[model samples]
Target: MSAAGSGPEDLARGVLEGGARSIGRAISEVERDSVTVPAILRRVFPRTGRARIIGITGPPGAGKSTLVQRLAQAYRRAGRRVGIVAVDPSSPFTGGAILGDRIRMSEIYTDPGVFIRSMATRGALGGLARATSDAVDVLDAAGFDPILIETVGVGQDEVDIVRAADTIAVVLVPGLGDDIQAIKAGILEIADVFVVNKAEREGADRAVAELSMMLDLAGHPEWRPPIVKTSAPSGSGVPEAVAALEAHGAHLAASGEGRRRRSLRARSRLLALLETRFRRAIEARAPEPDGLEQAVAAVAERREDPYSAAARLFEELVPPPREAAERRSG
Candidate 1:
């Protein structure tokens, strides 16, 4: 389809046709503008509720990709359509498998019921791939039963998929000194499930204990998100891990938590889109050259207070909250 005729509905139709190339092109546009993603999402919204969105994240060398591959296999074995987003290091995005080797997931790739895509944080993209979330929706709309998002075990900043996913599995391994400390805030605080992958490793037990204790202290209301230990390579503990994940999914679906969780995700996504749009509008209207550098220089020279300078910029961009009411009344 030409650019002029390609609207979100067209993309949605393309996605439903199982045309991976069309889906990839659709995601590129969504990534460029967060708002554009929501437009496609709106068209595919109802169709999306059918898939189970699973996010896997952890620190480097934690075996997240391998575990995701295994998990995809397990789901496919049970006669389900599975979609996977393999997120890898930025370097691999330039050449090698940032998303890991297609070979790792090669088993399920030819299953006819499984679909996979690779995404990475590259170049000026410091965060997760902007298309990651959009691609998930596309897969969801395409009738994939479970969409597995496997992100490289980076720190908090890269774990943004936790926000976009329906259920999150924070994968970890033993022998890492500050594993818990590294994942404390944005990532750990939001985990719906935890996987201690490479469970055969020496300190794997210790790592599981530490994480379990933290989860107990936090006190989730209906269910304590289970911690599953797994040796993804050897296939040990894979069954229990799969069972626990499945049970957690059922619980969410039955207890109305799924609806609540999705509502929260949608709200977060909408606000993020709004902020991105507002920033772009402000930047386009009042372009600031070397804006951050100018602010730093002003502070270093004591010509302006940093806090006041930030406030000045806010005033330049955002009108008083009542501007909306005025627009409505006008």
Candidate 2:
């Protein structure tokens, strides 16, 4: 499809037909937050929810890209179309991804049944791009099953993957100095399955033992996260990791956690959309010289406090409820 004349409906139709070009274009629009996004999403929303989203996240050097490639291969062997969304670190100058994951995953680049998209974090926190979830929705609408989301090797606080994936597999390596303590607070609790990649190393078993002990101490009565040892390069224990992920998927479905998670995801998406729209509205109302610009100047000059300026801007942008009702009625 030509990019020039393609309307949202045309793009949405192409996406639903599983055309790779259409999928790519749709995702680009999402990343750019284009004006056509709402129309395209409205058209394609019905076709989503069929894909089982899996999130893979851990610290740097955990070999997440290779492991994602392995998991994609395994799912392909099962005769499923796989979509991989690899969130890569943004380049400081260009604001584009370093694209290292694409290079590392070049082995599967030619696979006909696999679709891969690498997104830049673009200063968004939580180890994901702001547009990552929308891109997953596009892939889902395009008929890809079992989508795998590999987060930028994240720190303790970047656990937003929990709200985006049905199953989360936290990857860890043996020698990552105090693996348990590194992720104990934020990342550990989000794991449905823990993968100890590079298990051929000397301390692999010890890492597994420590993770197990942590799980025991956490005392998850509903479902304790399973630890899987994997060597991504050698392809050992990957199938077991896949199996553990599937088991957690099953548990989520059987125990009704899946529904709860979907609800939470829906809420998060709605709130994010609302925030974006409100910001846009505020920006539209606050033009240069006499609006937000003047307010900022006042605050910077110490003539007005930030809180007071913000309140004034909000009031100007959004009138009181009674005044809004009167305006509407008038």
Candidate 3:
């Protein structure tokens, strides 16, 4: 963490110099929505867009964490600095991560080449923390190449990972029952690579065959996602998975899809930031009775419809276009 007196410029300078503590502090500020966030982002924005962001998502109990750890190890072997952001389900009582993914990745904690941060979903939808993308940018600016994001894997909504990662790998385990049902949960469309982990298990081949059949049915003409089998504990098949991811990266570049994805990412970030700022401004400027609070109470008491209450609140907080124009002219 950065010192209490350190300014945003100093913190940003430390982040650019690859100081792990500074990186941690910067992400903490982002998560807190600190007053200095805009300043820090301004300084670090130019240093971002250099890292490869990979999103690993899948059904629960599919060993996604192990795969992420293995992938980090493989990237480390290649002498690449790796950054990991693991989004865990929030604890209802504390609003903190329930089971930190870093525990499963204990081996890599000591490696100076690897930086890992575990984030709580904090009730955000889409299996990702709201601040996860910002955290990735912090790591990227700190010189980590190949940043890995592991989502909470809440089935259907996990597709949100596509907006955050350059390439997404959806992991599945054999013997999980009804593989088709899992695919139908919306992960099938977002996967750049399908990984059948626990390959030594009885139904590994069956899982692969089922995925292949589905891909055939879907017909991806531009680039078909490849399936790779791996047993992460023993590190078997990890190299092949890495190769498949690298191949996808190459295809994305050669086919111009990479630029398209980056554009989408930028758009998503802008919209998210705008939404956040609007909500904050509304709350901060609400009247003493708090327009939002009164609206909620009214709707709860059945005195007013939610739609009407929301419109009233918006009108109260925001001037109508004609009023604004007249005021400016006056």
Candidates sorted by TM-score, best first: 2, 3, 1
Worst 10 residues of 2 by lDDT: 89-98
Off by over 4 Å in 1: 1-9, 32-39, 90-104, 123-130, 216-221, 287-330
Q: Candidates ranked by lDDT, best first?
A: 2, 3, 1
Poorest lDDT segment (10 consecutive residues) of candidate 1? 90-99
lDDT per residue as tens, model 3, 1-330: 543338999889888999888888998887776788889889998999999999988776677777888999999999999998876453221123324554555668788899888765455553243477878988999999899988745554456654589999988888766755755667768889999999999999988998899899989999999999999878899999999999999999999999999998888778877777778877887665756778788899999998988787788878999999999999
Pairs clashing within candidate 2: none
How many clashing pairs per prediction, in order? 2, 0, 0
Best by TM-score: 2
For model 1, how does the per-residue alpha-carbon lDDT over 1-330 read when each residue is reduced to its tens digit? 642246776776777776665566666665565445667777776777788888888776677767777887888888888888766654232244434455555667677677776664554333344467677878888778788887765555466665567788888787665757865865787677888888888988888888888878888878887888899877777888878778888888899988898897778666766776776665565437636557668889999998987777677667787996898799
- Residue 39 CA error for candidate 2 (Å)? 1.8
Model 2 has an lDDT value of 0.81
lDDT tens digits by residue: candidate 2, 1-330: 543348989899889988888888998888777899899999999999999999998876687877888899889999999998877563221123426654655657778689888775455553244477888999999999999988744554356643488999999999766656856776888889999999999999988888888888889999999999999976799899999999999999999999999998899878878877777887788755658779878999999999998888888778899998999999
TM-score per candidate, chains pooled: 0.79, 0.88, 0.85
RMSD of model 3 against the true structure:
4.1
